[model samples]
Target: MELTADQDDELRALTTSSEVSAAVGTRARIVLWHAEGRMKKDIAVLAGVSRPTVDLWLGRYAADGAAGLFATKPGGPREQVSADVRSHVLALTRVTPPAETGLSHWSTRTMADYVTRTTGTPISHHWVANLWREHGLKPQKQGTFKLSKDPAFADKVADIVGLYLDPPGSAVVLSLDEKTQIQALDRTQPLLPIEFDRSEQRTHDYVRHGTTNLFAALNVGTGEVVGDCVPSRNGPAFLAFLKKAVAPHAGREIHVVLDNLSTHTTPDVKAWLAANPNVHFHFTPTGSSWLNQIETWFGIITRQAIRRGTFASVQVLVRTIRAYITSWNTDPRPFQWTATADEILAKVRLTQLNIKKLVANNTK
Candidate 1:
């Protein structure tokens, strides 16, 4: 069997491309070997198939050229699922299940059963699951988001992000926040050391020794942290920590980026700002605490130091925190802010538009 130049190239691609399935590639090889003037028995050995299989594919190629190689044998007619049923399944999956069903969300099994009973169409959970995958639906997962209500949100974002991206010469920019109510928890039983096949284990129950609050300031340029474990989180505590945090950068102008908390705007804080003209405070938008870079450091400290430590007392926890900060400062790595203010605003606007459309649809 002789192949046209196009047919030869196409067949070679099917046999060599990683994406082509093994079965299809093997069939392509059989056709190529036949076109190469190889005997059916030799082609069968080379292609790892019976001599009859080679004849079958060669016959197909003879009849329809290269296209016949990819044609699948017909499996007969199947029971067609109505378009209305598919639309109904998708619509149900997108909303919360009815209160009568005692379900907060719809599962594949429950959705299938409900559709079967209501539509009088026999459907399996497997079919419903496939439909969900095709539509990129995942009922098992959830995400959280909050829209900032601060009227000056856009301006505040520009100011903070500007400071992050391009700070003034000889100025120190600090992302400051307080992690409140850090509990010093002690396990009831001793922790079990990890073995060859077992993970390290600790008691599920723990004794709460005491709680402490941590006030932290992250220097954006150097990534060094200035933190203190205070007995309480208040205006006075915050002001004291602020003084300590800025002590090293005494001569330089300081730009402190912080969240909008009640303690942050107290009369005493305002008085301190008035007393020190060099220190400026920039508040993030309300309900948008994530704009501060210090929060990222707080998460890292929690995962590494405090979460699994056995603290007999708050003092022990404090010491542990101090040690961790000291270790972090020795080789600090700064967190880089890459998103531009315009990019952030664009995404926020898109989110707002989507939320508006969602609310309008629900009302209808």
Candidate 2:
């Protein structure tokens, strides 16, 4: 292990410097010891390593200088699974299993079995799981989305977004919607309250009393809600709610943002709208109820009031809902719409393009 002046200096520096790794420093020290005319057995004992390790590093330095000492090679044998097998596995994950396969989604065991049966290659389910994880594929889970196809989508979006960004002078902008079929479900047994070291529990079974429809009007500017519970959600029920809900702000111009439900557009409601000249209705685009702010309020009530509540009857449920609305109005905070029309339209266009490309690929 004859060393150049530079190689000797570098090895000395590595042995003393804190920056170099312990493994590399050990190897450097081993070579330096060999250069000092020490036996491989002596160097191994001094460095707390085996005689073979000392010989290995000394030979590496002799062959490739400092570069050889630091070069790393993969230690294990070649992969048992071929490249074609991995490619076939990945491709299968991205497609639906054939009907005859009797699979809804590809589990590790099912995919491993299918691969071995179809391709005559033996593989384990653990190997399949590891490969899928490495490639960031999750065939068992899915997400959801809705695409709006209304012809007047652009105009409807502009109308709703404008009301949120800028409302008419001396007017109230209200986002109105109905949460229907709220069930009054009483558990068969009493709920167990949370204890010191245990979680709350409830019975799996319940007694269904009945259901009710909640008609809610959210003042976009103030975040205050005018809400009422009705037995049904129809044109007549909606008109009745509107008359009572907006009676307080009678003289002022009212701008209401609502979804494009059939009841909202019926001739009876349209006639009532025409007669009320001061009240204006802005319809959100089809399949885009998220644009209506009242839907946000509905989600809050469902989670906080109805979902976990134990109501013996529909009357109790309605009373509980009214109490939540009253409390909400006490400290109302306006919901802000941040995205501009251009930003929204750009996102929609990109999603549409992606969906079209996917459809085209699937058809081919």
Candidate 3:
């Protein structure tokens, strides 16, 4: 192997630079030596590094060329926990109630305890912190899950979400979902924002006024969201909300994308759908409400308007939410959702294969 001018420059930069460490220099030297047709052990001795390091770097250079050498993470030592243990911890963490480890919901302390007691291998709390940070795992103050018993879950979801991805020739695509709990509370102190003289924060404890439900219908293509606040968001109320959300564009064939909640497909809703053949309802799969565009809008509302605000009552919350919606619509843009159905199905299929392989390996 003969060194190209680019390879020579990179090798010279590695040894003479202030940016990278000696280990990186070792890698660079291996690159230079291997490029000059030198053997791995000979390169190791000349570079004053181990033979395997030279061998590994040479192999990497052969596989990916110069970019692979400097791509190593320049950080502290990685965790000592095995991949199996890390997978086990994540699997357990995803489970709800989390009472097996004796906490209402998972906390860092709870996770640390489970790692120590269940595996019979005591791990440091600092290691627990490092693990969560490394994995982008954290405990939210409030997180919830929905369990649906809808029979027509998958097909309905595919149809509804499909409209957003691949819409009809000339029709509006609306992804609708009900966000049931909108708490109205006047906090002990006002929420503090991070700006100059904006850092004065609020107390978590607040005066409970009431709660409201926001029935949202978002037009994916048009970036239009229309919603209403109601005291409840069950079957009857949802039907009424639907009547309002759909009535504006009556007598036209419009696609309504909704989640697989039992109340969403009640006999009343079925009768309504029958009455309005032009208004078709598409449902997202169970535990797949994230597929809805209105869900994306809801997340923005949570972060921007609701989570930190202190509303005096349900009416106040409604007013604030509506105002925020109006403000958002002023410069509305349709969200660009890029995940393909193939990618999702591939992930599910891969997980299934991994589970099967794990079982087979365990049995063996």
Candidate 4:
């Protein structure tokens, strides 16, 4: 293949320019490579396309020049959905389905059926789905949010986040929490072992063998955990766990990040804090226990060990938990905190503003 200087420059520009579509760029590269005396098979390998496709594009280019390399929209013209019909679909999608329909939310099929019957448009569910996608509407999905009611939410958040991002020198920072009522369950029948093509299975029913509480303290600096399985979750149990957790770090400042639980602030806990002058508590904002790092560890343990375990007794469950903790400490990796307090507060402020706007619109 041979090209004029003008054709070569145009082809090079098409391949290099960011404004050109990827398909166009690829097509241009194929032609340029062919002009450079590369084999059709080599071009096929480099361009990630079949030799047949390379031949087709080369044929198009030879027939129509640079204009032929561009792709024309595929398929016939779409059925024209009128502006009124589009507006109607969008408006209904923004609201809950009518009470008479007995639907809490709208699905593509239900919305399509309703629109077809009401407007006599005979719209297909697929069409309704495509229209919804074009408008960025997803009535099937939902999310959850909660605004903290604590008066000192900002200060508490700043305190905890500061500890995470920059801990005090020579001080121990621990995220402490209790996983309460961990039941020891055993399946009534023996678990069916997994086969080559099947998953392991167990009976849906189980025998409950009592419950225990776990108090875990996650070391922020090293990702190590100090844990205890106690019979109950009370101020006494928490105090005992705290003493055990901080025993190794005696004579150094200890910062414990915990939630605002009643037991956490009980008289016994207050007395223990008063007695231990080096120990300090940094409570997360009310109703924001998710801020505690130990909660993440709890989730990990539940998913990995507790949820599927067939424990014959609470003792077995506790031992399993202890073994898991020991294994974790053998190679502990700290969860890195990236978001700054300012970034978090800014997002919360934006959410609050949006809520206010929604409330005002609803009132109107």
Which candidate's lDDT is highest?
Answer: 4
Q: List the residue pairs that clash in candidate 2.
A: none
Cα shift from native, residue 57, model 2 (Å):
47
Clashing pairs in 1: none
Pick by TM-score: 2 or 3, better one: 3
Better of 1 and 2 by TM-score: 1
Cα displacement (angstroms), candidate 3, residue 152, comes to 6.5
Lowest summed-lDDT stretch of 10 residues in model 4? 194-203
Candidate with more favorable, higher lDDT: 1 or 2: 1
TM-score of each: 0.61, 0.60, 0.64, 0.60
**lDDT against the true structure, each candidate:** 0.78, 0.75, 0.66, 0.79
Please, what are the lDDT tens digits per residue for candidate 2 over residues 1-364?
Answer: 4554345555666665565476776787788667656788977876778888887888866644444456455575544998767877776666556458976566566788898887778986667766866876655432123457899888888888888898888899999999999999985532222211113211125889999999999999999999999998999999999887788899999999998788988898889889999999898888788789998888678656776578999999999999999899999988888987777777678666655554464455
Model 3 pairs whose backbones collide: none
* Candidate with best TM-score: 3
Estimate, for each residue in 96-184, the C-alpha lDDT of model 4 and write its tens digit: 56568876566566788888877777786667766766776655443123458899999999999999999999899999999999999
| Residue 104 C-alpha lDDT in model 2 | 54
